[model samples]
Target: MFAPIRWLILALQFATILPTPSVRTATERDIRCSVVWFPVIGMLLGVLLWVFQSFFVHHMPSLAASVVSLSIYTLATGALHLDGLMDTADAMGSRRPREAALEIMKDSRVGAMGVVVCLFAILGKWSAIASISPDHWEPFVVVPMMSRLGMIWSMVVAPSARSQGLGALFARKIPRWTVAVATCLCGAVCGLVLPFQQCLWVLLYAILTVTLFTGWMVHRFGGTTGDTYGALNEIMEWVGWYVFLCASA
Candidate 1:
């Protein structure tokens, strides 16, 4: 298999529940390079979602169709980012010292705060999907693509909170140039499907929101973690939907 193709496959394996050929000899460099493919995988997921929603909305209530689409979306990604959101919420909601909060984030147990935040995240996306005009399908693709792009940005700009874990590994090994490449890919996708002005607004919203959110995470956790990266992705998805909805409006 070609190296770039393998890297892309590794990325799909890591970020999604979608089945792919296993890379038994995947190197650390491969792992790092795979970050470049995150947005692509997101776009793929978005396409899946957009198609599913378009089909189901015709056969069922819009709300029910949205719920089913959202469920498929969650399952497709294995709810990996949602779990991150929950863990990060529990940690931040603990109001503990930075180190202790990090500890809370590491625990497998979900807390009350985690549940509340996760619920809100789901509801936010659901409402946005249900409320969106049936003619507006760009949000389905752009939102996922932009959110994953936001993850790449967060990983690049923020220091890792710990010396270990997936976040630190990515932060340490992912090439800085990967950010430019990923952003360009994301921009091209958005521009193809969205109005020029709306594309620009969506991109700006993603950059600004991710930047501000990263800063807050740094202040609270001293740096980004794997959990926080996931948290950012979820946050971007929720907010990205609304931004697109407004842009289209």
Candidate 2:
């Protein structure tokens, strides 16, 4: 649990605007902990986001919450995941060979396809969250947890599309067994935190979404990359929220 902290703190500084301690040199163990603990931070962010938004529910509309959520999300990681999401769309747009796809992803400029995809992702997520009433607070909380957990799970299991990339860095060190532990822990947390019936549905949806993403990744880009993981995070959050809330309804 403590192992990821040193590495995580450094990563977090890049992804979020947190008041972190001075950037310290990290060991491989620290890197391992980064992969493990980074997702946990996402979970914590879920809870904090919900609490913050919920506190203002009476004073603000759903759109306001969405804006706040989006703001917090962008500010949290400085849109690190979102950048990955865009890079992935550009790669997919190419529909070229694996090397071409990877090369296209590396280009700093965002392409037209990438722009539309990212806009859709943000608006899709915002609309989904914005439409929900405060009555579905649990789903809001669970959705973020599931999405982030799914990202972590993908990192553990999915092969990196390129030999040299951020996904490769994390995926390289992730033990195969870590996937099972993280999946179970995510389920256990949801079970303990969510309404009983909703718990089952949410976990199932998360697992299903994770599986579907794995398939899409392997089939389309040949394997996983940081961009795919980010897109997966956004997609699965919507899936989890939709299913969990619908089940509750």
Candidate 3:
């Protein structure tokens, strides 16, 4: 059900743009495609990075290069996931009931715990990209794609932890087919950019890890909330780096 693949990108951006409002505007059928469009966004961002890397990471020393690259790549999204990661971390710190955790997540206040997790996740991505051999641009182009897929994984496996929330609408409307298609599309992109062995390994590890992690969250939370989904995306991508570390072109 690649219905309106073109609109998939629009729907994805729409979720970020109109957010909760989009659910009211679009039919339920459009919901899953919204999540599916994430990798496409990542792919577009990756292409931009691929195009500009020489002007940034290539010319700079490794540490400086990583910082420059992360800034360019993440600033495009205004560090959206980073914000989610931070909020999720703060929420996790609540150590209370689900309602309390979500309340903390929604608070505008940024706590030290949130900042620490955000900083570490950001630095981890930078370090992974920095340590990667300069000749391998595949990881550069593909990791973002995989990272977005991680978001979808959270949406797919976990039920909404709460009723009448963002995660609930997403979980209610998103289709299983969209997940399958997104996975295949992601596989195709990775195949184009990576050798068979490397692509297979990274994908296998990513899929297994995401699946297991999503399952754990589902069991623990009895479903997923918006914050948990955000947390899942950040965690999965950080793990993706270590998984890919074993693979090569």
Candidate 2 residue lDDT tens string, 46-158:
76667766766677887887788667766676777778878888988988987888888888889998999889888877776676776656665677767877877777767
Q: Candidate 1 regions off by >4 Å?
A: none
Q: Give the lDDT of residue 197 in candidate 3.
A: 83
lDDT at position 184, candidate 2: 73
Clash list (residue pairs), candidate 3: 161-224
TM-score of 2: 0.87
lDDT of 2: 0.72
lDDT of 3: 0.71
Which runs of model 2 end up more than 4 angstroms from their true locations?
Answer: 1-4, 7-11
Give per-model CA RMSD. 1.1, 2.5, 3.7
| C-alpha lDDT score of every prediction, in listed order | 0.88, 0.72, 0.71
- Per-candidate TM-scores read 0.97, 0.87, 0.84
Best by TM-score: 1
lDDT of 1 by residue, 59-152 (tens): 9998899899989989999999999999999999999999999999999999999999999999999988888866777787788989999999
